[model samples]
Target: MKKILIAHDGSKSSDKALRKAFELAGKFGSSVTVISVIPELYLTELMDIDRARILETLTGETTRTMEKIKASVKDVRTVRTMIRQGNPASEILDAAKKMKADLIITGSQGRHGAEKFLLGSVSSKLVDYAECSVLVVK
Candidate 1:
């Protein structure tokens, strides 16, 4: 693969996926792009909150997270990090399409019960809709 995209959310499963992506990148000499998305502020919409301030705070947090990820994978050449705001699955898919990534790696959130049934996990959504190959790490 020439380009590999990783969907990371700082969970244990996502950390495993990141390692796997780095390993594959090392083997194939592929460029790696890590993307983290901030979900829409649905709850904040209901509350009397400063939407812009909340969004700004979230953006800063996401930036810090991406920076830490970049530092952790400093050995890997051609590593890129991106922060997006929207539905995680949709944003990730869009990023992959824009980057022309050959592979998309993401971690399973392991949501169960009503939540999983009502709203499918991000990994599942990406696997079902992504045009490119998707690897869902547990």
Candidate 2:
């Protein structure tokens, strides 16, 4: 692919996906964009102060994750890193569309049983809704 979009959250699964992206980039001379999203709950759920604190903390973590992603793809010539606050699937899809990525890659957590039922997987959601081609790595 000429343009690749990778969704990362600093998890091992995401790390693997990142490595795969780099491999593809190395092979085909593709440009990759890495994105990390911090879930932002509904605004009315918490007081303004509490919301600020949570956002601040998550923002810090987002920064760290983005930095790590940057380091991982440092040798790649056309890699970019970004941080967004929202639902992971939505953010990823939006970014892919914005970047006009030919391929979208993400990691699968493989949450089964009750966990899968309770909290829908981001990868699955993206596969269902994303307009571009997606690769969900294990």
Candidate 3:
């Protein structure tokens, strides 16, 4: 069965990307793997390594997000969820590779000009570097 990877971050844009992934998965009779990349800030050496707290928070948030995304899927595609901690762009690409996903779906925050210059767009970087096809949802 086809596999599609979605990069979600609890943002509205990311939610839209999730919907798009659902659509594509339905079209292709594909299974979806929803991946949430917890920013490295939460895993820094400065913070107390409250493993239980961190895992709880991540699990709850990912569960909620997955529920919303799953509700939008009209097809009977199988689904899987994953949460990882790292840089969003690299982590997303790595997850896609590891899952053998045929497509990588992510949202573009629509930042432009100086803002985008200062903070490089994750979607842009993924589009450039991902081994599979990337669908950048607006």
Candidate 4:
């Protein structure tokens, strides 16, 4: 694989997936792109809150997370980080396609029961829609 795309959400499973992606990238000499998505705030419109402030807070948090990831992968060659605001699955799939990634890796949240049913998993969506091969780390 020449390019690898990893979706990280600051979760333990995502950390594991990031490690796995780094291992594969090392073996294949592939460039890695890590993406963190801030979900669209549908409720913000209804609530009397400052949309820009909320977005600023979320962007700040995502930046901190990405900074940590960058530090961890400092030894790796050609590691890139991105922060996007939108649906996680859509943003990730869009990134994979735009970057022409040969492989897309993501961590499974392992959400089951009603939660999974109500809020469909991002991993599942990526697996179903991504044009490239997907590896879901649990």
Among all candidates shown, the one with the greatest TM-score: 4
lDDT of 1 by residue, 11-111 (tens): 76788889999999988989999999988888744655577778888888879888988888745679999988899889999999998999999876632
lDDT of 2 by residue, 61-109 (tens): 8798787677766546798888888888899999999889999998876
lDDT agreement of model 4 with the native: 0.85
Ranking by TM-score: 4, 2, 1, 3
Itemize residue pairs with steric clashes in candidate 4.
none
Worst 10 residues of 1 by lDDT: 110-119
| Candidate 3: 10-residue stretch with minimal lDDT | 110-119
lDDT of 4 by residue, 29-123 (tens): 99999999988888845554677778889899889989988887844689999999999899999999898999999887732323533423888
lDDT of each: 0.84, 0.82, 0.77, 0.85
Model 4 segments more than 4 A misplaced: 44-49, 110-120
Better model by TM-score: candidate 1 vs candidate 3: 1
Off by over 4 Å in 2: 42-45, 110-120
- Per-candidate Cα RMSD to the true structure, in Å, reads 3.0, 2.9, 3.7, 2.9
| Residue 81 displacement in candidate 2 (angstroms) | 0.8
- Model 1, position 37, has a per-residue lDDT of 90
lDDT of 3: 0.77
